[model samples]
Target: MEKNLRLRKNEDYKKVYSRGFRFYNKDFNGLCLDSKNNGPRVGFTITKKYGKANMRNRTRRRLKEIVRLNRDILPNLDIIIVPKKHTYTMDFNSLNDSYLNLIYFMNKRYKRK
Candidate 1:
């Protein structure tokens, strides 16, 4: 994703983690806070407990790709996607579907307020 559209700072992640509205599915959880910048920004976090570096990187890549493809439709918010353990073994198509579902859920829930 583009640098301007990424949540890169430690404080940014912490703000989302501590105060953002949350949405979730069996595959992952999303934390979203209204954006303070010109557009939406996203970040991904996969704990070391999930796997070795390679596996974590692969999962991060999958999530990032999904977001990149759908960036135009995303609302103007700051989002952090945290994947569950199940994602490690899941196929990309299924993972994509799950991530989209979670985004749909976020849109519905976040927009009501």
Candidate 2:
């Protein structure tokens, strides 16, 4: 993902976590807030509880790839993804499905606001 398309600053992540609405499945939790930006921007967090640095990095990479491929599904939002222990073991297709399901739920919830 490009620099502009990522929520890179500590303040940015803090703002999203503090103000965004949240959603989750068995393996991941997502927080999203509306943004004035023309496109969606994303951030990822995987705690030490998940594993060592390499394992966390791998999970982050997987999440980033899923977002990159499905960017069009969400726009004008800032999102943060926090993966659970199971996320490290889930297959790509299952992970993608979980993500899409969360997005769909988010969309529905947003529309009601």
Candidate 3:
């Protein structure tokens, strides 16, 4: 999971949280995004509330894959994916769609504001 393409560093996380605009969908416990111009970066967070170590790791892996796959469609925006308690039971396709859905939501949110 740590070696995943979309995973970000500590400093990157801080920058994204500090500088990026955000909007999330309810189905996504995780985030997907492209790095911004030295402004914000993509990021992810999985709390203990998600599950045990394996489950958390799985969620991270799923997010990384989905983000990596959709890299082209995303913008240079910072994204932070947080997992829900039930995230463990979700299938990969659902998890994948969650990222797209959230990004869609964010794009719409940005368009409005």
- TM-scores for all candidates: the values are 0.94, 0.91, 0.73
- Cα lDDT tens digits for candidate 2, 1-113: 77877998999888998988888877778899987587888899888888999999988898889988998887578888888887888899999999888877777776424
Query: On residues 13-102, what C-alpha lDDT tens digit does candidate 3 reach at each position?
Result: 766566656565566543434454543344678877767889888777777777777876665556687767776788988877777887
Worst 10 residues of 3 by lDDT: 32-41
Sort every candidate by TM-score, greatest first.
1, 2, 3
Model 2's alpha-carbon lDDT is 0.84
Tens digits of per-residue lDDT for model 1 on 24-109? 89999899998899999999989999989999999988888888898988889999999998799999899989988988888887
- The C-alpha stretches of model 2 lying farther than 4 A from their native spots are 111-113
Strongest candidate by lDDT: 1
lDDT scores in order: 0.89, 0.84, 0.64
User: Which pairs in model 2 have colliding backbones?
Assistant: none
- Candidate 3 overall lDDT versus native: 0.64
**Candidate that beats the other on TM-score, 1 or 3, i.e. the better one:** 1
Q: Provide the lDDT at 61 for model 3.
A: 77
